[model samples]
Target: MLMKTIFKLLAVALLFASCDDVEPTIYNGNIGQNDTFLSFSRSVYLLPVVQNQTGEVKVVFNSSTVSDVDRVYNIEVGFPEASPANPETFTVPASVTIPAGEYQGSFTIPGVDNGLVDEVVKRFTLTVTNLSDNEYMDNDTTTINIYEVCPLQADFLGTYTIQVASEPLGISAFEAGEVTLVEGDSQYERVFNATVYPGYGGNQQVTLAFACNFLNLGQSIDTNVTCDVEDDTKSLVHAPAELADRSAYDTNDDSYFELTFIEDSQSDCGSPANTVLTFTKVE
Candidate 1:
């Protein structure tokens, strides 16, 4: 009876141990009985540029091989026949080489110059072929998008009614004012000038410097704004320096400004009061 009981315990332990060794299977359709497979590192790449730039595309193997010598691979780049920026606009390498015992290789596309003034997005495609070894290329291709950075200045330069308020402090019903954007010192800069009247019986003239880009509307006027609230009295408001957070947008032929201003010092009204300003372009 004792020997039978010991055998049963041992069998149960072996069963639990076998179950613990089982691993979840991750299905990979690209991997087959062969150990070598080539594929692009990414499917899409966005290249934003104003002048000339270089972009790289990487080719990786599923598994590294112990090669004594370098292996070469041929790649083909295809561009839209109707693309205005065609072969003359860009150049791609004909092939890439992987060093011995390496699992990856890269190809460079050079001389990507945006000479055209027209703001248009261009794209090209790449495929891997002609493997030096008896390896297979995965059924995948990569697409490269080239975007020209054209500043949208004309779209945002106009007069608009702006309303400034601080709801938490019960400040509202302010007088409407106009804001305008003039050409700045550079092609990417804009001078933001506005005069706002607050319900708290004070006039604030705001002059901010802004940066313009193709990705979105215009960004903050400047890093900070110094306002002379009263005679011989000046206050500073910390503004966002980044483009995305502190920018204005245009929709349906109307320009809009949604920004927050944080005071640098305490005032009689309040300390650290957040002021939100919203503006709409007037026809």
Candidate 2:
């Protein structure tokens, strides 16, 4: 009797251990017929412009069995239905191989700056072609967006003294103080935090882009300061000035440039459009 009990306990322990070692099989739901599937790790990819102007896209092999030898899969890269990117602007690999005992691999996509317009996003599609008699799963296709980007120019980033040169909404909406300009997404943009309305109790990150001294004001940011007593949902807003003169920056002197913006431009506060805050650099 004692021996039988010990054997039963050992059997239960082994059963639990085996269950712990089992790996879950996540097949593409579109094709439940197959035990193995090939999929892109992401549905969308942003190709960052690096030193070589190239980026890698990861491909994952979802299978319970790991092969001892490398497995190669064919891929097709083409433009989507309409408004496809220029064929000459980008290049992708024809095939990617997963190494022995590895479940994932990556393929390099070379960025070709062949007259590609800066800041224009172009899209291309990548599909894994070897699955289930050429029938692809939903996850097998991935879209990639590429754009021409110039390197960040270092001269524009730093701390500078700021003060309102013009206020169309009200007085003291922004205080005269120092603010820092940091790097933005592309070479033409800069980001900074300004407390446009202290009564609202938060500083909003302001991003502005410029080309040839012409300013591109970013979207309005929510100050979360409700001006309407009836509607708590309505809050004050701040954005780069839409005014023509203040919107333009002075390229002749970066040390003394100006930032203009409208406070309560949306008229959330009853006194909207009363102030347009223009900040001039002092440093």
What is the lDDT of every predicted structure here? 0.43, 0.54
Query: How does each model score on TM-score?
Result: 0.39, 0.46
- Model 2: per-residue Cα lDDT over 139-192, one tens digit each: 567777564434433366688777776545443456668888876544455778
Mind sharing the TM-score for model 2?
A: 0.46
- Tens-digit lDDT string for candidate 1 (1-283): 1111110101122211111111112233223333455555544444444444333223332223435466676668877664434555556677777667565566556435546422354677777777545454444356655544433434555676767655433434235567675543233334454432242233332433322232222221111222332322332333332333343443223366555554332342334445566767677
Off by over 4 Å in 1: 1-34, 52-66, 81-85, 150-212, 216-283
- Point to the candidate with the largest TM-score: 2
lDDT of 2 at 8: 9
Judging by lDDT against the true structure, name the best candidate.
2
Displacement of the residue 181 alpha carbon in candidate 1, Å: 30
